[model samples]
Target chain A: MQVLARHNVAVSGVEGAPVIVFAHGFGCDQNMWRLVVPAFEADFQVVVFDYVGAGGSDLAAYDRDKYASLAGYASDVIEIVEHLDRAPVTFVGHSVSTMIGVLASIERPELFDRLVLLGPSARYIDDGDYVGGFSSADIDELLESMDSNYLGWSHAIAPAIMGNEEQPALAAELDESFCRTDPDIARRFAAATFLADNRADLPRVSVPTLVLQCRNDAIAPLSAGQYVRDHVPGATFGQLDASGHCPHLSAPAETAAAIGEFVRA
Target chain B: MTQRLEGLPADVLCGYLEVGDDGVVTSANDEFLRIVDRPHDEVVGAVSLSSLLAVGDRIYLETHFRPTLQLHGEVREIAMELVRPDGTKVPVLVSADMALGKGGQFMRTVVFEARDRRRYEQELLRARRAAEEAEGRARRLAQTLQQTFVPALVPDIPGLEVVGAYRPAGDGSEVGGDFYDVFQLHSGEWVVAVGDVCGKGVEAAVVTTFVRQSLRALAVQWDDPSQIIRALNTAMLQHGTDRFCTLVVLRLLKEDDDWLVTISSGGHPLPLLTTADGEISEVGASGSLVGVLAQPGLADARYVVGVGDSIVIFTDGVTEARGEAGSFGLEGVLGVLEAGVTSAGDLTDNLLQQVLDFQAGEARDDIAIVSIRVQDDADEAPAPAPRADVEAKDRALRALQELQELERLDEAE
Candidate 1:
């Protein structure tokens, strides 16, 4: 299936070492793990990849029906792990990808050794008694904000953002290319991420799991993180001093330290 | 001059503010303070920039805006809304850049009121969504209209393997003018017809339906292929429409161990005949176009297709399909046949796939193909079974037959 090329998979660190696969969240690509990846390189074989419709992955492979739900994204992860031929690897996921990792691990429990969910949320919209931190109307408003900002992302910078092979240097020169995605694809991904309900799927996890919550996180609040930790069987909970949804980006030292301690233990 | 310079930041039309690394508002001009409707003392050194944003905008800041700024050193013209102390929202366009200072890294930002621009952009977004929805509805309507012109399933004709394929031009959003049908006549003979109308979209679709239905209605009454084409031409001429169509009709009748095939064309491409020995040739005689002339030249060609022989009929969409080299001419069709396909399904599939690949997967015209092969005896092998298996197989077969009968009853309704 050319899984490595399809996801733009990048592998580094020691050969034949314990593997750690990092999956990015909805807004960005594998580059989100740049700071933390360096911390794992000395001892662990670190892997990172862009999901379809993001970064340098093949856009022709994006199927609207296949990617309409989080299951489609989970299938990609399973394919990557199977294709890597590496079983029982540790998985680290951020934001919406945390739920994606959980789904994948549950579907193929033998492929994963442990799961690290950073700023995880089982649901983003508030339910009857569950406080997911945002209302349904707020998510709609977020989609609107995405639409308004798409004006700057339209044609002028799209070629560079797409990492055009003809002008590789131009794509490489743009630091913003990591988070920039095709606006239409991003809109679909946003809906699939924020509107997903995976609360019921939590207790099905059989792997050893760790939930890391960031203080003052706006997207995935502390309560949502606690809900995930409470639901997943034998899941350990930790809190980071980082003040945003992205601890790997905002506080890479502390974030990597916590993950390092857990993996080593 | 010094006093004027100090007042410049306060008097500017856009609001200016600065935030420390922790996102706390460390400084704000009078204009910035007024935009959020907060006193400078209460806003600066106390309020965080993220707290001033609406909930949705706050998420946008954390997910998109902040990441972009941290990576690119700046973010420009991001649309967001700020919540005032009284809860009124103010639409604003914000641009910010991060820089290192003596106090540590801080962000300098400029905010401009954009209520009018936001309203205009919202209108544009709504219009785009409306246009997309209308396009989706039209495409579905065309598809349903197209299905009425083309038969859904060809009846299973004994002793003959019949297969047909149709591909719409471009994205299938507009109705294509190509259609094919296979049906049984009252005389127990089978008729296969392929046609192409003059144009595309709703107008051509109307003519296509008229021509196809008229042909089917006339076929049952007449036994000769040439006579059928003639009657269809006269009916189209009297129908009072300027649109014309090209057609080829074939009549198949089982005679002893072989099938007698009769073919006629009305300004349509001739159907191809493939013998078991790998011989390929055109079958039908050329005739004048239907509906345009009072006395259109029409004639029938006859051939006996024995076991291991096949016949293929198609629209000009196949022969006239444009490719990088040129049109996929009659040679292309012969080339596919020359590849030695064994079954009716294989011939139709190979021909269509070659044409599509030749055009790099985009069909410039609608393509319709129908292939009929005289089956070899060895092709239909009976199934072997034990006593227990036979009983189970009979039960499953009875269930399938019942389901098919129910489906036919539903269609009748």
Candidate 2:
């Protein structure tokens, strides 16, 4: 286990086999990528770590003002890569983490070879020219709902997690999951994750990038994935036939095949 | 070791089934047949996927289900009430996805028992309702507490009529602390005061009550308006909490044909005066808020109120009340008085209504207004027109009186 930014990091597989660092998105810890990691563990070094404020991480180390901006997370990635002494490393990030990976790679291009950004969103709000599904007022309502139902956070967040109505309601499981987290920590992490805007960093990534987009991801839409592709120069875009936000859990075979081929190529 | 799939017991698998794109049932495990209460061969190729649903379930599947699948391409673990061949309903959760091939597409659906979820949902609904009720009760209690701090109506004064009003800051949420009071002092001098505390909630309300009582006590002993304010400021500084308050005090004395008003202000708005001729102006005051600094420097100004002349004293909630673009401020107060709300009750109600209208019913601060009209005392023997007016009218009478023999000489001639 590796300690990254006060988090307990678990790394498996062989050393120097094209290190694929898996970065998970908001609300979830590193365990969401468990199904995808095993596929590459035999041939490549698989690195998985919870974000400082998530999963089985040390909750005491989470700083509010420091984690207020996504750049703080991006800086943590750079430090993690530096500590591993791995250059030209491939980073596989999901949801908002995809944007964080891109920002971190741009800051230190020599440390990374390529990026695999899954379900990326440059801006969640709709402006005059951009429509990222939700509006400022919508997000405000979401925040109010979260605040009002703070005790039942898991159940409250289920609709937001499964933003697509196609999936069955997981309110029961979600409510239980929410109970696992300390309400104060979850509130702070929620503010940090959903409230961040990382549009400016998308253009700065000079590394070869790949976006594995789900066809009907409720949390992230296809247009948002296309926006990421358009912004990152020479970035490859691949649409997958997966439904949920966590494709590794829903359609592991397709996600593994796509990620495997992209890293090999 | 009997290998149960993934190292679990064989009986654990409640139900499992696979369906084709054309709604044909191709395969089913033992557990699936047991859940549907049907014979294995009887169910195969005989029933469509929608056939398993009841009439109500079919409607949901058609409207909310098919549209979501068509747009998003796949769905998983959605709860449904399945209809058995015996016409009995069973709750279950279903998950399915589309597989793209050389031909077109195929659907794979899995169903499981939903006993746990149904119970959990019922519990969640119950808890949510309870929480909502508690929140509603808290809001009502806060509102009731807020009303106690404000008076329902201002008392009428004889000889000179009086009007007063108050508005607390609230926007569909918690209440605030804004207070106004008019009490007759022991010396028959009426003391009118309006003030706003710094913060909100029960704490501010407590301080407001204390201030109201303390100022009333000080007014009884002190006749000078500025001295009363200074004494209140000292009392607040000594006994006040972390929160501060802004106050304005006015002392009214009945003068013949006019009323002498001694005004003292502490970080409060100036009083507005409307003359009998319909001209309006703000009676400005210069002082700091009470309980903040050691010496608030209370400033007192006097004004003579003639017959039909009315003066309006109010809190910032009146002046700061939002208009269409700018604010009501001193201008709105003057405009309301100019409309001729002469009686105490009318003036109070009209001014309060004007503020409420200007704010568009969104008053986020407490406001207080007190107005008094001066009555002309024409019955007090008229004061004999003074020595200056009498001296100017008759200079010849004075000169003739100065010449000692003027009256005798005039008679002899």
Best by TM-score: 1
C-alpha lDDT values of all predictions? 0.84, 0.69
Estimate candidate 2's RMSD in Å: 23.6
Per-residue lDDT of A239 in model 2 = 90
lDDT of 2 by residue, B1-413 (tens): 87566522335565665555444566666766777889888777677566676533342343234323433455555666666789776777766666664545656566787767756765775687777775675565455555545444444455676766666665534656677777666576677787787787656766776787788789888887778878888888888488888888888877656678888888877777888888888674668888888867777888887788887777778888786868887777777887885665688889888888887887857777777776544322222223432332243233223223433544765
DockQ of each: 0.31, 0.02
lDDT of 1 by residue, B79-182 (tens): 77888989899989888888788997889999999899978977887888878876776676567656655666666666788899999989888887898888
Give TM per candidate: 0.86, 0.42
Residue B377 Cα positional deviation in candidate 1, in Å, after optimal superposition: 6.4
In model 1, pairs of residues that clash are none
**RMSD of candidate 1 to the true fold?**
7.5
Give the worst 10-residue stretch by lDDT in candidate 2 chain B: B379-388
lDDT of candidate model 1 versus the reference: 0.84
Residue A174 in model 1: shift from native, Å? 5.1
